[model samples]
Target: MKITSLCILAIGLAGSARLLPSQPQDEQAKSSATVEGVFVDQDGAPLEGVHVLNRIWPGAESSTESDGDGHFEILLEWDGNKDGTWYEGYARKEGRAMLKFRADLRAGQEFDFGRLTLTPGGVLSGEVLDASGAPLSGAMLLVVDAAQQASAPEGAQADGPPWEQVIDRGSTDASGAYEIIGVPPGTWFIVAKHESTWWLWSEPIRLEAGKRATASPFHLESLPAEYQIQGRVVDPGDKPVANAQVATSVLSPDGRFMMQTTARTDESGQFVLFFSRLPSGTVDLRVQPEGDELDDGSLLDVSPGARDLVVHLGGTKVLRLHVVDDTGRPVERYGWGLSIDKPGSFVMTGSAPAFHEGGYATLRVPEHPFELEIRSDAHDRKEIGAFTPDALPKVLEITLTSSQAISGYVTFQGRPVPDVFVELVQRTPNYLDGVVEGHWNGLYYGLESSTTHTDQSGRFRIPNDFPHITYYARAWADGYAEGTSGPVKVGATGVHVELGVGGEIAGVVSVPRGLPPGGIELEFYREEIKASSINTSVGKILRTITDDDGSYSQPHLDPGTWLVRVHPSGTLLSDLGWSEAKVEAESHPYVVTVQDQDTTYFDIALGRDEPCILEGRISVGDKIREGYSELLLEGPFALDLDFSGVDEHGRFRLVARSSGKYRLVINAGPGHHQYKTITDLVELVPGTNAWERDLPVDQWTGEGIRLDAH
Candidate 1:
């Protein structure tokens, strides 16, 4: 992932390579039988009543019923689905009865059949405590599975192991004690969150079948200490003053300051303020009195306590301005604005020119360095660098110039484009890679605006009034293609140009044609230039699910080399929380090229993965705890799969791409503490899921505080 210091920073993840090894043909020749058993949760010690089926049986279909012993009988049937010559593998039948299933099942007739014994699933329990050690009511705990990491949402993404599962949910109890039951037996990751900002994440834990896990006490810290500022407001003669409003603010290291408290001075000329929370760094103090003008200022180190200080008043600084035309001749009465640069921040002052017979007016500050910016209606602007203290007291000077404009017409597919927002994107070098950055509202050194919504005839004008020494522009319209132009020098007038829209691409996405038709999702990617080369993913072109018709499209594209791919929305499902039916593209690779005048059409096929089903439970001491719990997983030693689970009888099953080593973690819902590192590395082979784990039992058992199940 790459990180940069922008207004809003974002990063992308690197793709993982496919690594499950292939099975031998000789292994497929052996006769196999089905081994069936009962799923008894350790906490409840009861049988799971729901029928678990392997539909499209590449694997044999089996049924089980619990006897008086709490163990069930396994009955088997022969292969229900056959693989044709062109097919590579079969679907593994597994999923909740109501939700969707996307995995294929492998043939089960090759393995040896025997009396399969199923053990009770595991449990995770713990207490949520505040800074004072008292239970904190209303906290939340979350669990994430480790194997399906690629597809989970934002907060849950970091909790899962490298690539197993990703899910988030949890809530706390009235006493802050939480028990996450019904977790699968495996490695899981857990987290506890309070008040949205304060949180705690546990190291990965593993729970084996029939065992319960207890977590070390998890405590939420108190809010950070606050600081108090008090000062007096007085005139230049040092006399006591009354009713002067004073304000406090702290600068953030990344270039911003949040206002704290604003209060007025009392009859004693003194004002007292208590900041809610002091920011963790250097701070600046600002004081402004209401009514008749009196200037006062002070700077101090503000820590976590009441601070007393004194501020003195003085004459304000006078500012002078002049508006000039492109010819350098003075112009009268123009719209204008002013701004200032303070440490870690900036503020826009009064708009409209400060006018007087002498072209001057007075302003005041705490006697420090500041940058002054002045702008006018004619599109001209001027900036004066750092102004420290002037030895001789005087007024500041500002001069601006008039600007020129560019006019032109635009059309898409030979028709005038109207009611569309036309953006004038200027190309600028990105320090990290050299390629032009993405378009944004126009600014001089940054993106600056020109004009928008051309008139009925598709003719418009862009006034060259911003600070850029030079500019290049691009025009864009939603649902229609965008066009770009070569660089145009700033300050030049009467430049003319025309824009044209390109053709579109569309096609159907489906699974390999020979198999029984099933649902799948498809996504599109558009290759773009970045850095000095084109080796990275610049942006996503089009993202749409295949309809029952399996059709998709690249609504717009610049004629160029194109690469298309289809995959089960495994990645997108985990990333964006998208539902299955909406994504129709295949989960395989495809390619196509679009020419300037060609409306390209094509088709793509996809491949699917086998499924593995897991079952487990959560417990505290000797009792069953009810509530939501999540499952988190990690690989051989790496964080990967991150998934979640909710408990009634404490059981859960999840899907995966391919299997390898995995870890498991479990957590309780909101206002609760969580248990972690309860399970260790377990192997997941295709067509088999005899996997079992127990979350360590948390011992909260005592005389009248027992947890009761309804």
Candidate 2:
């Protein structure tokens, strides 16, 4: 077989060589390279009419068609630089799956690919019919990857992955027969949709290479007549209010919230909302005029085909705001903005130009009860609730009192660090209260108040507009550890930041034999010191992906205890026969400490031990909530696992490497307010393991609690 394959490849190369055009010696020496290949099917038969493409350099692509003997040759042009050592080649035919291969070639090198076999693609065929048993032409058929469906919430229609993930797509013919070609072998779900009908999904189907899978005929149920809600916006005086915006939220059939079609009122204040498909429950409709709010929104029952709506907008009131600094002068050089607490709220912002006319800014708003917030960089943020425009004073006075400047110098190991980014950040008071339960000690700060870059002298200045607030002056450079100053009052002067010479962590991510290169990710987390007054922002954590050679570096790490972890990408893990885990073991986080300007080296090997799956449920006071959980593994090794779409019954699953202890941190959602940190070590053997627990909502604190393994 090997001799025959080599002979066939040699024949293909010789035949392809004859088809190449003779080029000038000078041109060939400067830019020409040859890529010759033979296209064959799984049965080793020559496949003709195969399209071949060579993408070796930017803006230069060579393309050709396979001859009758499946021999193809293309001459590629090498750009000015010849540093690139690899080029990608692709081949595909009408009925066969596409094949991608990479070849290493030097400049002017002639590359010859041996017999490249194109796997026969799977075929999906089915018929589409309406409720009346008549063929439904033009019905769209989509093949979605089953893996995407596995993560989607139950009852939610999975929009087949991104355009690239679509295995195949087609439309039914006049006879309602649909056939999709060139689908890669895998498990997939078929979805059919037609105009005027509801979407229908098929059960999962496993397709084999070069095989055909027939799906049960889809009988799409006709959707009810689309409902239209027509309305007109008028002022209290019965005059039309033109250019008003209307919006409404509707639940999709998949049990997810989606926005309804929005429409703006025309010149005559006329608007219409069309609903092609309405959810089973009530829909909430909100209307906002050009500058007014609709206090009484409509709870629409869209089941009744069409209806008319009328919204009465209250009269408008002009509120004049006067802003001035403590010196009684117009606060001209500060950023100011205002926001309303209503749906489709509008924000009016600008510089001193907004208050140009004698330091007074005018605003036109509805004469209704609403919440308003006015904020300024040089003043405290003010929130007014239930304020009626008509009841406001003729001129509202806003005092800008907090104007200060903080200047600092950043240095690393007694040497000035120039071009470092300096920022003033304030901690949001009570940010962790109520939102996070338990002993949540992680400090969360608000957005940056002021930002600046250090000059050549390593000097930075942050002009603070809110003097009443205290902030931390943080400094970070490309090759230095993040440094921060002690709490400095906004009005404080001469704040200095001493940055530590950062360290580097170099490591090799060794993958098991038979695994392709790349896809391994490394994450480094700086340990939080309980006694330290300075809190590192989450953004400071370092993450990197392994190179093709399985090496990675976490550079410029702070001089402190840090956690290092290595894990395969989600797709790779799933492909390795590992099931998702619900909780991560917390016992073996790789801990390392670094000194100033030092480099640490560590190596990790994967695939030696078998992997296991952990499944469990998260419940609050006996009731399971449908949410996601983040499992943090710590032991002899560390990894992070994220699981989503816990059913309404509160079940979840995660995958982990076996023979390791893990710490599982489960958060109901992204919000840090509610979470459970499990410190008790969960040991996983080489196989499937399960755990179940009911976390009392009120009893579980955000602190890491040790739970004895049951």
Candidate 3:
């Protein structure tokens, strides 16, 4: 009867299944399944040598290739159990979007998809030329889709997509012609980047299936000549400071310091600083020599031409500090920082002191009134302030108290949840609060100290060496909702936390006709209140992709009001591109109220595309800057959409996509002074959107933006 059941299971699995001969009944039972399929192109022609991947079945050869006749087979081995098992298959060729399929399988099941179709790929070709109309050789060309563009990291090469996101890439030949073959059918952005010139991009281009798209010739703009700052570094005795570090800073038009290039002095104590994108006008330049007592920084004018200069570090003040524990023993491995006392000055200079002997370290700074702070890994931080170096002791003594340990256990539904990760976050003053004073202080709390995991018994212990700080504990585990503990002082006794059973939200994302050709992602956001105020912060964003059938489920979501929406892959309009207003009108989000240990089902039907409008004002300081702001909208895949300038009323309007996050960069130049501000993660809704915001003056200080500077 068992042998008959195995044969029946194999035959019932699928019509295309192939059952192998039965194994010896005396031996341990061995069961296997076979899946057979054929690959063909859209026009019904067999696709030879296509690669088919089997991702659904584990413990098997992952891939196989179609034969000349486009026929392929996959063998899957299964354990004795046959309940609730499934398999997935994917087929692909170079330069094509993968074709996906899925099916259910049992221990002795054999399934055949019969024949699968593959979509054809496209091609992009173009030529690159210099500004003078001469063919530019050795230039790189990149093709990218919308998803790759939107998720690219900041400061990534603007000339082309990042290496990992490049769908197709090619280098210009002697004739400046480049061809990228096997580009999948989609809307793509093409860019040409030269080694010595600025990048040139094409407007969005659509490539149709099995067709070649010829793009317009790209003209590369010449880059400005390299600005050089050549100078020599010397000590107070006018002796060459060989191998000394030379640093420079450029001042912005708003009178803020911006750190620039750095170079180490050669044997001759001479260094040359090069700037590929040097700003114009006078720049504040500072030079510091390695292990020297001198401060040599000044203002210098920069231009396209190279110039010679010299810097001399005069006498500087050296302050020594000694760190020790409560036992009066020298403590090694400590960090210290210094802050100067001046209006609009929020620079905090830090150093990793090498406690070679007696826990003593030295620091060189300008002669001024300064506040000092010191901290260690295993101790509480210490701070001392308002002391002038002229009246200081030779070695300042600083003490640190030993850290404490906190132990705890995690439970869900009265049962221990092992392998739970607990995070200890320190709570500090909300710097954004209006009541907070000081430029850089009082905005946020210090960094989190340590993380520990619970054992099989749900027990966890923070190391005894953790710093003493007021913190709260948050615990989370796979397939479970997160839980938070109240603020606990590290010096207190053991803590306990209880997590609620996680719930699941399952749904299907479908387009008007059917599922999108490619994969789609669903974004889940939970609204949380900031501090103890009513201001809301978008918290705990969870993202998951849909399967081939456009079905998705996210389990272990904490009990709360969650806003769930579909984000279509690529530059599709109905997905992330919808505006908030349009989404509300169209009921785009599937708002679900989750309960502990329960499941909720919701289905979403994407809406039609609608025109989007964005209008906003640019304010500089307290006054609106009319007709001065230049805004650039950067969309998914780094598509640069240049818009018109601001009107005389300091207001600007733009037509954009319905949904998706954008980066807005406002550049304005009052006289020869240029100021720029960037606001990232700007969400756009359908219909009309209005914004009135201030454009803070861009700061260029080497330390960071001055907290007091506007």
Candidate 4:
């Protein structure tokens, strides 16, 4: 049996956009690309009712539930390739205590992930007590990893992180007892904190899969007075706005330091909110004055001054949003966003978004004019509303087109070059890539990217939601040089790229006996410019890793004198029994040629057999750097498997079979940070290495294990 369902939301930067009139639904059902996968429980039995969600950039989401047999298939947004899309998402059960199983999707291809297993988690119950042994009521209980909660503020180095994960949490009742189900099986410590008492932790408890563990009582002490935010909400005329919804929020660009709490004002329009401690940065106090029957209220942005705040609110305008196709028919599912001076979501605590399903919504938006961005999986995006405050409309209707696509081909000397990976990028300001780049923190910028593999005919199509903007298409294939189509502007029927057969290189890598294949990295570099007859290193151009048989190959090279370097190269030594290691051992740079239509062969025997030890003493803390966890040597080579622990005197050692210049990353408390890294590269020869100075924990910042196997 087969089943399918879709949910999509379209949101991007606040800008201007337009929609084409609606067409018949059947006319919009052209692309037939599909992807499928399966889900099972820890017992290997098919798990049903799993929600599989898929999303593309510019806010397009599609979702479906698993059938009885655990199989699910979803229709992809097919433009044939005119606009290739980067797809990502995960599959999760509704209420099971299982961790979310992420789906590994190729940039633009469709495939199955065989069988994904979801493990049902265990449960945890606990009690809270005061220093005097009396039960404490209304204490918030949190379950987290024990490392960060250890008796001392010492640090440890872990392959991944010191995991301050909030696995599960619950609040204590009249008896000070709390039970939280769905706590994933793991070693956890319980933390109890009440408004009137200090935060305290219980001893670490390692839980069994699908079982239960009761935590010991936590004895907390009396807490001092916390920072209280004083505020009031009033109408423009100075009249008190009674029972106004108020909230104090602190958001930091870095994930550190965040808190949010909601409350309502009394008859005097006065409200008080408290935080465990005074936050360091900016704090936003939002107030929504209660509106009468016809209005739904709006939020007032305020900043606290001297712990006291006053805000004036005149309510807001009602915006009725309707999204339709070319034929004026409602789109099935869509998401919209609003932004004015900056990008932000208008979502608040109590509003329900059920109305988003029918391409319709009634929103109580800020009175200030703002841009409304809407989208659906099949439709093109455009900013629809950016009205002047006085001209803001009560009802806004938008029309969109779903038949948008961009098609093209890659050819080598007039012959089609199949199997090429085509990449499309738009450079216009406020475009798809522009919007995603700002919010994603430099993860993907300026390049709103779409990717797809060329078909047998060398033809490709990418669904173009922003066809009105200019784009550039680049392609690279096995037998042809990389090609680019510059300035594929709006209304361009196709993007044509011409490739040439440049130089090609192939080689086999020989490593130590037990070294598995595919972890080695190779970087290609070219001289800054051919100013002189000889080539001199400037910047890197390309990089590739070895295949299963320790072989690597690449074609489509630009004709130039190339120098291949193994600077900072390593291989991942993965599990023979669930452990992994990153072995850094590579050869020096080898000069190669990229002459037209030529092929070069080079063989490499990596790292010497002799062992090299780089040992050092290290400690961590905000103040006294004592206690040792584990630290990371990111460059050259890493020995995550061996003992790199520090002793009571803060001494440690790291031994690797191979050696090179390495970087030191002080990994502690959840994870390491930019500040924890040592900029100076420590070169290790065939013997012992040292820092010569006392190693310090400059900065410490702070996913996954699958236990489905029975």
Stretches > 4 Å off in candidate 1: 1-300, 304-406, 412-415, 419-457, 461-472, 491-501, 513-540, 543-545, 553-557, 570-591, 607-710
Off by over 4 Å in 4: 1-125, 128-190, 194-198, 201-215, 218-247, 250-274, 278-283, 287-367, 370-500, 514-548, 561-582, 587-593, 608-710
Q: What TM-score would every model get versus the actual structure?
A: 0.37, 0.45, 0.38, 0.38
lDDT tens per residue, model 1, 169-250: 3455777776554445676666665542245656566756556666666676644334456668777788767886566564
Q: What's the CA error at residue 583 for candidate 3, in Å?
A: 8.9
Worst 10 residues of 2 by lDDT: 1-10
Give lDDT: candidate 2, residue 680.
Answer: 37
User: Model 2: runs farther than 4 Å from truth?
Assistant: 1-121, 125-139, 142-191, 198-249, 253-256, 259-274, 278-407, 412-418, 424-452, 455-471, 506-523, 527-539, 543-555, 567-589, 599-710
Q: Could you give candidate 3's per-residue lDDT for residues 443-485 as a string of tens digits?
A: 1122334555687799875544444566676787666688777
Q: Which model scores highest in TM-score?
A: 2
Q: Residue 367, candidate 2: how far off, in angstroms?
A: 21
Taking all chains together, the TM-score of candidate 4 against the true structure is 0.38
lDDT of each: 0.44, 0.59, 0.58, 0.53
- Model 3: residue 331 alpha-carbon error in angstroms: 13
User: So what's the TM-score on candidate 1?
Assistant: 0.37
Whose lDDT is greatest here? 2
